[model samples]
Target chain A: MVELKVDQDKCLGCGNCVVACPVNGSISPETAGGHGPKTEDVIMMVENGVIKLFNEDKCTRCGTCPLFCPTDAIFLE
Target chain B: MVTNTKEVKGKDICVQRISPEEKRELAYKDDVCIGCGICAKICPTEAIELGEIGAIERTGVDESKISIDEAKCVLCGMCSSACPVDALDLKLDEKSIKDMAEYPQLIKSAEISDDLCIYCKACETACPRDAITIARILPERSKLVTGEIEIDKDTCISCGICEEMCPADAIEMEHHEPTSSDPTVSSDITVNKDKCVYCLICRKSCPVDAIKAVCRSCSYGDYDLNPEDSETTGSSFIDEEACVNCGWCQEICPVDAATVEKAFEGELTIDQDTCEACGACVEICPCNVLSFPEAEFGEQSDKVQADETYCIYCGACENVCPVEAIDVKRTAVKHTPTKSKSWEKQLSELKT
Candidate 1:
């Protein structure tokens, strides 16, 4: 199990993490109702032009998203 | 029954055997083999013998063909698994082994396909065991075909780093199966072309000559004031003929809009009509190209002059001026001396 957090102030909204994530449906754009949890409960979504962790349960803890973040906004604990 | 006996050290050696249940055969595809001899070396039971090219030519067979003795084969499937080009096939229980699927503990060798190889040397640097050797087949020929990569099975540990590092995907790992721990995922730097501003800061910082960026417009020119006032003030303009494309402006720009490319040549000129006699340019000039001629009493000091031959065209003075008086451009008229030395001396003597 792992925890994911996004620093809204530091994120440039480059969407580099979205492209680097190996898991599908893990990172996506935020919707009006916010992102609902998929089959894999872990989800990262963009809301108000910044990245946010919608759910943390489904994450595989691969840490690929953090590795690709150019601004170092995403943190995994 | 055994036949084809040969005497070795006074002992009879049986090279051929006939048995129903123990029958195992190895097939070779002659056209695909590059005569690398990787398969014959990796065979655990020594059932496959790779003959020399000269011997094979005399025997009227393909130079790369290997002889497989069925009697000595244990059907461990090492030869077929190690073949870089699917050139060898192993048959057991009359069914052809379709997949060379087995993660052997020791990887004795690896092979690369010459046709698919781009000779990038990513594998040569990535190999941890130092077993791979890439040489030029013909130094005088084209560089594309010059690299001929070979692996020494005796020294290879089957780490599979070469396969993972190959940019062209030309290398194939034999005997040792790739595992989740084998570092399959490779990292690469990618740029979004649409989002790029072409500032060329990356190009300036690069230690290697990998990134090339060229900016043709005055967008890369640095001005202290608004860019919209460029036409009205003519404060900053790059002389492309003089620019060496060193990317110094690109590194210093705050907006990341600077690019170094071909543009018109410019010479420094002062507009006498708009002159305020400000000495900011003279003080800021690194090259001391701008200077104000001393004026005597009753003589007006209203203009600044630049020595055109000494100017490096760095645009430092143009950016520091409060009033957009100095125009650094290609077409500005040269400044002419309005005061004579005799007139200045006569005026000074009268004032004293």
Candidate 2:
């Protein structure tokens, strides 16, 4: 079955996707994930920079908000 | 099953897939399209050659392949989104130079989305050549995609700074969980891809990764610093007419790019990418130093702190200022290991 992939370099943090997601954490803003034991995570925006430890378990896979990007920066694929 | 994207051989891809539902539902097969009007309009590139794709369009198979023109290309980068089949690519027209990098036996390139991202910009960025340019500009939300602190792979001495200040748990120093004995098999930065919005604050705070970061491709124009003039520089121009010198620019600038250059001159200048809001200069100045004129605070962002007194002009504060808060020509500061790190990395690095 096909699944959604969030391109980290393409996201703009508009919060448009967060607002559009129907499921909680279905579609979150992040990158790279590994098996539970491996602990793969994404770099996030900390105060004025990047935080590189976001959890994948937080994702809901919902494809609502990525559809609203005017720049096509956010996608559900 | 046919893939949602169809590849264009030599042409430029500029058609974005606006419908997330349509992308998720796209079916695919080998030689199925007959250049029929069916998938043509569906194709963002209009790249289908009639007889080229006849397998599935004729009815025998469930999918077909569409032939694409390799020459008439502009690379605005959108066709991958247009394909209802898994043929087109949404990646940049040209691949990364590393697309051809030779991995020594001791240095086998890690398999990134190995199933997909053969172009390893991240590894390049993480490792050496200052080689990483974040190759693929996937159209999802490119604007918010940049890292917060500047990780100048060139100067990144690997001394993770800006890592200490993260209160939101955003940055991290990824210890690549090696898939094998080769520590090089990058676990690097496993971005919770869906969780990050590319705020770029991370890029700025890294203390290590610093880039001028002005997206020249950004047509928004440059930093028309001389707002009094009519020229546009792609940055937020200070509209002298409307700019009441409220210090909004100073505060709004996450990098402290904007500064109250000469409050007496009634003009503030944006330093761009070097300013971190420690509020030292703002607090030291007796002239109600750089601040939002309206002084409005609505949970939008943390209010800047100001304590004019005790703010000795010894320039000591500015010297330690990570964001370069003070005009050195005007004051002084001492050397301190003011560091910032990816909060997420700090936490995870601290985690088991």
Candidate 3:
């Protein structure tokens, strides 16, 4: 299974993953690096056009988050 | 020496004339720098850290900026694109395309807030450098060691897992702080046991000061002329109550006048203070020449962890061999030399 490890340092929290994710609930935002495996953060991060969030469990292992990612983050394992 | 200041000093804000030699190095920051051709476009000398856009230096900087690895960058921009005169020259390496592949890793500086880390160890499980140490924070008399974050920087890949999962915001991704742009050991870290009393001179001399003062009841050949324990016994005492017939001290004695054995049994003996406590002789002598007697292995200094295996044993190092610390036999059997899956490296890659 392709697991996903988000790069919070670079994650702009742009919500790209939130929108790209096939599952309704995968990925969220936390200013801090991580969050519970489920649930999203209240804010969003967008960096150099790349986006990321603190929500971990929302990911479906689709790899889509990293695929469309401009920054090449989101390792889908 | 540079303190965090809102005031941009030196080359940070001012446009300084750069030398051709300095223009050679640059590390790119994708976001902070807009890559407005102005940096490349305005170079008075046409010097900038250029990125690979199109065949022509087009409208927008394709991606990547031009900063040399932290230590190498002279920060001189005779060719800054920001210059209106267009004198700066932004040069890149032929292998830059490959460098771009290593980008994310260049940017991440692991950051942490003290409150967020729960020692969940999720990140620990993920870290490849074994750089992240989960030391327990001990309050005076708390009798408990709460987790403290220690990094063996040499091995760290700059991954942000600890920063990512830290519920308490304790871990952070910091900018790569180059210990030495031209890394050189401040001094040699070898132990000279003969002329040396166990006074720990080199340990005090280290700038990074990667040394520890370890005290444990090491085994001494019962026959040692100057047994470190002799001081406690007021010269020496043969504990008839506990003396075992296995007189190891006599066989391995370099000076055989005071043999600890009835004959040359060749068991081997040890000297606690002179031992360097490297555990080397114990691992190699085929007989255990030393032991760290339940020695609460002093809270290992971060440098020790940092130095763990960096020694190449190549003798190339003017300093100690990173390999000297490793026991070939123990490792072959244990195979547990602080494993990590490049968590920091991956974080750095994504950051780029």
- Indicate which candidate wins on DockQ: 2
lDDT of 2: 0.31
User: lDDT value for candidate 3?
Assistant: 0.30
Cα lDDT tens digits for candidate 1, A17-71: 5544433232231221133323333366555688776565644443456766888
lDDT tens string, model 2, B199-303? 444556666554323333234333522333422122122322222222333343334444432211112232423433323334323224344334455644322
lDDT of 3 by residue, B213-298 (tens): 32122333233333332321112223321222222322322334222222111111222222222222222121122234542466
Each candidate's interface RMSD, rounded to one decimal?
31.8, 20.4, 21.9
Cα misplacement distance, residue B313 of candidate 3 (Å)? 48
List model 1 lDDT by residue over B140-198, tens digit each.
Answer: 11111212233344344444454444444444444334467863332223333433334
Q: DockQ for all models, in order? A: 0.01, 0.02, 0.01
Sorted into a CAPRI-style docking class, model 1 comes out as incorrect
Worst 10 residues of 1 chain A by lDDT: A24-33
Model 3 residue A69 distance off true place after TM-score fit, in angstroms: 9.8
Write down the lDDT of every candidate, Cα atoms only.
0.44, 0.31, 0.30
